[model samples]
Target: MAIKLEKVVETFYQKLEEGKIMGKKCTKCGAVEFPPVYACNSCGCWDMEWVEISGKAKMHSIVMPAPLSTKPEYKNLGKYAYGEIELEEGSRFNGVVRGMTKKKRKEILAAGKLPVPCHAAIYQRDGYKTVVFDLDEE
Candidate 1:
């Protein structure tokens, strides 16, 4: 089981390096799991298939990271916040969203834009790649 889990993680990063965001689609219930899992959360089905995601999502809520809780590895990200992200394929998760500053958050809230459009991006880390999102320009 552990080895299988490791393989899933490895494959996920490998796909990101190839510029493709992947997710697992449950054959049983047609639910998609982002950051691809090995089973379906909706139906307890282990029959899953890999699929490239659309890279499109909506930001449902944003929460700024506190100064003390900031991680050094994220310094290069430049003004980001954690938010509830819902992928176009129906997966919902919390993800780091770049380009969201305190002032921008205020503006978005004042203007009544609670849920905004965002797109996925693969970020290059020191020795690995990961996914992040960018808010669509107003």
Candidate 2:
């Protein structure tokens, strides 16, 4: 089966190509949804609006990818890990965070800094752009 790209997804990618991060904000409850959706997840409302995100976020948890489980497409990402990221606008989601190695992860965990500050970046893929996060400097 083929996956269909919804209008919201298409618009999101278009904005990424323009070097902007966009999200859907609920006009009713003032909740924002990153990775833009057509409806609001907070109040189950369909009254959503497109908003440019600040790309500021926090990584609450980190899980490194196993050596054998790494994908070829991500080989160019250097060191990365999956993490639960919370946007500054109050949206939470799991996303790939670049610049994280096992050693770095160990060091961070030892320091008891779980929810570290991170900022989003637009990564150029083979044919498209995507969002990734990098740990902020201490």
Candidate 3:
């Protein structure tokens, strides 16, 4: 099981390198878990399979990073903030959103667009592949 779990994580990174966002689809309940897990979070099912997410999501809230709390590894990630993001496939998760400045985020809030459109994209970190979201213009 440990080796299989490692394979799952490895496959996730491999897909990210190819610019495709992958998730795990539960064979039992048909639910999908983004940031893919070895088993189904929705139904505790072990028969999950690889699935590609649509990269479409909605942003519900934003919290800019604190200057004192910023991590060195994230310094290269310009102007990103954390937010509650919901995927089009129906999964909800908190994720980092790139390109969102304080002013832009305020504009989104003032415009009454709390749940603005967002989409997932991969980023090449120093030692790993990571995913982040951005405003979904479409």
Give me the candidate number with maximum TM-score: 1
Give a tens-digit lDDT track for model 1, residues 1-138: 999999999999998999999999998899999979988989999999999999999999999999999988899999999999999999999999999999999999898898999999999988999999999876
| Residue 131, model 3: Cα distance from true site in angstroms | 0.8
Deviation in angstroms for 101 in model 2?
0.6
Off by over 4 Å in 1: none
Give the range where candidate 3 is weakest over 10 consecutive residues by summed lDDT.
129-138
For model 2, state the Cα shift of residue 3 in Å.
11
Local accuracy by lDDT, each model: 0.94, 0.92, 0.88
- What is the TM-score of candidate 2? 0.95
1-138 per-residue lDDT for model 2 (tens digits): 023337788889999998889999999999999987776888899888899999999999999999999988888999999999999999999999999999999999999999999999999889999999999988
Candidate 1 vs candidate 3: the TM-score winner is 1
Tell me the spans in candidate 2 whose CA falls farther than 4 Å from its real position: 1-5
Report the alpha-carbon TM-score of model 1 versus the true structure: 0.98
For model 2, the run of ten residues with the poorest summed lDDT: 1-10
Model 2, residue 60: displacement in angstroms? 0.3
Model 1 backbone overlap count: 0
